[model samples]
Target: MTDRHDHPAAFVDDMSDRAEQIADAAMRLFARYGFKRTAVDDIAKEARIAKATIYLHFKGKDDILRATLQLLGQRVDALCREVMEMKAPFAERLMALLRAHHCTAFLSIGAGDHFAELRAVIDDIAVKERKAFESIFVRYATQLIEECEARGEITLKRPGVDPAALITTLMQASVGAKVGGISYEDYEARLGLFAGVIIAAVLP
Candidate 1:
């Protein structure tokens, strides 16, 4: 579970304007170079502030990475929630949520070029930050499926299939959508196609 400090929207809410500024700079650099390759000086250079200024806001590189990931989490969290509220068909909203969660993330990291770099260190460094956000994502997806079924907008074609199970399928499919050599357009289209398959499988 996520703590108060890990709240998606509030993760950087308490930061001084300057701290947020520095973290934002670090985020772009980390996206470009990966965590290990990004240093305090690099972040400072990206932020166009003195290296000492970064220390005032963060302890070290890892701390900035946490903040960076949190920032990204906040955006995805907000967008997914927004998509869920759209006054559209359940299937339409489901596709939008997939885009909000996965495609936006892919483009945010520059269409998967350095995804391996920043992502590789995240497993070791910001696992909690990642998990907390993912939990919220899963919750939103599950709720969307359940709500659609309750509204009679859709019914599972098979008995004993949990809405959460559909979410699991979507998650797995999103990974394949980002495989090497695909454009953002292709990644986004693949997600829509995958979600459509899931919906069709359960649509009644």
Candidate 2:
């Protein structure tokens, strides 16, 4: 019952669109009702798609949860690609990329109880999706640093201090900044300072 030739690219986009919709709806339900309490039927109602239609795109509730986390990763990854093409300076672009990765996830899971529940569900079931996002961020961040160096925007002052190592340190510090229960404003402030410290000696 499908078009004989939906055009491969267009077909893929359509699939992504539907799957993303289902995942979006699921994430809202998971955040509001807790992941365990949110039934597949609830997701179908939220998405306005039949339960059967969801199965066409996802295996079940767990798969839908994974897809929801993946949506966050995709958003960050797409933002990084967009920032890469911007005419902005490396520092500005780097900050945008940082927000693209961190703020995006923060807003997606929301605050307090929502963040706790969603994070627990992700850890319990969608660990790969969570880890994949980190990997995606590191890959892009490392590339951005390399590009900045190549453009003479930055240079490593110390031998053996490479982009990957520097980025890993920045990322670890950024994650550490989230500890001890911080507000969004505090988190953003800390992120700015941490990033500055990591890039200080490298930037002219």
Candidate 3:
């Protein structure tokens, strides 16, 4: 019979830290070598952990990928919140938000062939998480639009243009610009221009 009390209070914390280290190593490998080519042994070697130790934290490669995506999602969410809380004007804040999002996406997927490989590896999970995140993002954008309008920061040129629809279009355009081969700094500048156009279109 083993005594569970033999383990120190830091045992669980240590395990969690080890799990994060493993996930970080896996992310680097996934970025450098495509997910299919990155084996558990490779991750273990990168993290300097025994191959069996990975099992203590993750079921397998798929599970590790899921964990890494979740971490990425949390970081994006935090960035969004930070931008939303800024003291800048609505247009400036919106531009900042779009820039943060695009920059984060580029960093996450633009390194080597990570995006294509990620799409191939966990398409379903990726789609589900993306849709969920986008839904929340759109809602927040709508709220910002409404607040801006109320504050006279913007006024709709066409009263028929639904705030939600306009926000969705802006979000899609921002993403499309990135996929269309524009450089990061250029994309960011375009985001500022886009936000200005949006505000101009709605200005009284």
Candidate 4:
């Protein structure tokens, strides 16, 4: 029920740029120190802006956390849209989607040595935002799978191969890969193989 725009200074013309700076700084600090240990002053110092300046575009630390997660979500969504818009076969498009998802996961969650700590911080403050973003991701994946099936690009061989479930399983596999400390190259290769296997199973 709390509208972000209800804040008096939220409408500044340069708000988007400022918010990006604040979020970037916050993400770095959160990665370095964990969320509970990072303070607004730390972000302000890292961003080279006054603490009050951050508040001009965000309500507080939690707001900044939400904004940061939203930015990441937007990046993933953009990648999904790009894959969907490609003039390629459904199999190629699906591979592209899986590659994009892996790349995004690597950048967002695997790049940092302290990612587990950072993830815990985010989970505490933005569980709903995370869940919503994941739901959108799953929806996109499901749409792609259904479209492929409809176009005769893929046929469901297994009796109950739900697209949503398949996508969810893939997502969990990617998370496990990251948590297991697999190198990005290794993870991508594994994902490529996994995608191939999934496509092969459903191929007519």
How many residue pairs clash per model? 0, 0, 1, 0
TM-score of 2: 0.81
Tens digit per residue, CA lDDT, model 4, 100-178: 7666757664555667866676688889877876766687788888888898888876787767667877778766666
Residues 1-204, model 3: lDDT tens digits: 855457766677788789888988887888778788899999999999999999999999988988776666677778888887888788777777776665676566544545555656667555666665566567667767787888888776586766876787787776655555456677677667777877777767
Measured with C-alpha atoms, the lDDT of residue 157 in candidate 4 is 62
Give TM-scores for every candidate, taking all chains together and pairing residue i with residue i.
0.86, 0.81, 0.78, 0.83
Candidate 2, residue 176: CA error in Å? 3.8
Q: Tell me the lDDT of model 1 at 13.
A: 68
Model 1 spans > 4 angstroms off? 1-14
**Candidate 2: where is the Cα deviation over 4 Å?**
1-15, 179-183
Q: Distance from true position, residue 151, model 4, in Å?
A: 1.0
Give lDDT tens digits, candidate 1, residues 13-120. Answer: 645667878878887776677677788998998899999988878889889888877777888899998998899988888888888888777776636467766666
Better of 3 and 4 by TM-score: 4
Ranking by lDDT: 2, 1, 4, 3
Task: Please give the RMSD of candidate 3 to the true structure.
Answer: 3.5
